[model samples]
Target: MERKTLITSTRNLAQLFATLEVKEASPQYSLDLAWPNSHNISVSIKRDDLLHPIISGNKWRKLKYSLAQILGSRTLHIVSFGGGFSNHLHALGFCCHRLNIRFTAIVRGDYSANPSPMLHDLQMWQTDIQYVNKITYQQRESPAYLTLLHQQYPNALIIPEGGSNKLALQGVAEIISELDQHYDYIIAPVASGGTLAGLIKATAHSATHILGIAALKGQGYLEEHVQALLPQTYQHWGICHDYHFGGYAKRSNELVDFCNDFYHQTRIEIEPIYSGKLMYAVKDLINRNYFNKGSRLLILHTGGLQGSRAIGQRASIL
Candidate 1:
């Protein structure tokens, strides 16, 4: 009887993934920068931002397998931790709503006073938005706190803050198969380290070097998170800590100006939080002649454009 039920759940989840209408592969476009490339290096962007308006880019990739596993299990309720304007929560809320699964977003800080655009969407999606203090939220990954949550919601599947798990790595690694050709270096913005770790896993045996441009201030902290998710040791990947600007979601005038100019030059929309910092780092590296003369670089445009709506006028390029 249990086996029969499991088979049915697996079929249902597969059908749901099929009906999700997500783009199987995002297109890559050559970047035409206004500045000249003195090193004769070429840069192309894998437009994963075009994956979906909401569940786009790394968000979709990171959550795809997790959602599949959740649906195959007896658990129908999902509990996750994130900030009020988190793209992970926003995408997960939409997916859960579409699948008719119960979702509870354990958001950090009291956004009830001034809810973000993401929180508003969560409400519309019928998600249980639970705002907790920073101190309590800090215990999100603690075994004791997770045990407490397991006790509270026995039928719930608890996803970590950014949905960075082994399942997420599997989905993220799929990006490598979708690529038409290989490049010397593959670069992406690092947040929870899942995306970078995924790229690392995909190119683990390959000669391609993976570079993660940090969007936040964490140096050793982010590396530790990436290492935890990786199955084995890999020296082909490294994280750059210079382009964080001012930590996660924090923006600067210089960064904003660069994003705006980039839009005018290439017409590719980027937010200051993630993609902006990524492009900025790439350009800075290029100007500093970081890449060899014949090196080709592939930039992963991990989409979180929806979260930009929360910042409103801050993302003037959007």
Candidate 2:
């Protein structure tokens, strides 16, 4: 009976993933910047955002292998941590609901009075939402708390915050295989470092350089996280730390204006959190003549459009 249930659960999980329709390769297009550039630098964006409406961009890549492993192991429950406007939790909750897998989102703060759009979705999906204060949330990786969580939900597969793990790197690395052409620099927003790490791992052997635009202020620690995920040392990748604006999820008026202007000019929507900062950094780099003359750049648009809705913007623009 247990084996039969496991087979059924795996089959359902497989079918749910199939329904996501994550393409083998997402669309890529050039960005015609309105500003002048003396250097012959060209920029293009890989629209990973179009991977799905909900399970979009790098979130889908990061979770792909992890969910497969969990389901293959017959684990029917998932526990993970995230902030109020987390794309990770939002995507996870939707997938778990589709697979009939129990999900618990250990949210980092009390939002009972005013829940974010993501929190509302979690409620709609019937996710077990547990609000914890910042201090307790900091102990998420502590062995003591993990042990306690194991005792509480023995059957649940506990994923780390941002789903940055070995399996996630594997999924992110696959992005390289789908690309039809080579780029001088392949760029993506760096938060927990998994997505950038995956790019680094993927192109470690190639001449293509992986550039991560840091969306937050953790310069030193973010490098450490990426290094830790790497199997060995590789110097083909680097990060740009100056474009974070204020900090994670904290955007300045300048950043917001840039995003709006970018959307208006290119008809490509970007939020201030990740893609906006990345595009901003590219613009700055080009203006400052950072890239070599005639160099080509490819930016990965890791989608978190739902976050735009959280800030009361049109979800389409995020």
Best-fitting candidate, scored by lDDT: 1
**In candidate 1, residue 171 scores what lDDT?**
88
Q: Looking at model 2, how many pairs of residues clash?
A: 0
lDDT of 1 at 300: 95
lDDT of 1 by residue, 1-318 (tens): 999876876786576667677887899977767565734888889999888888979998999878887777778999999998899999999999998899999999998989999999999999999999999999999999999999998979999988898888988998899988879999999989899999999998888999999999999999999999998899999999999987888888888888888888888888888999999999989888888898989999999888778665345664
Clashing pairs in 2: none
Alpha-carbon RMSD, each predicted model: 2.4, 3.4
Best candidate per TM-score, number? 1
Against the true structure, what is each candidate's TM-score? 0.94, 0.93
Which pairs in model 1 have colliding backbones? none
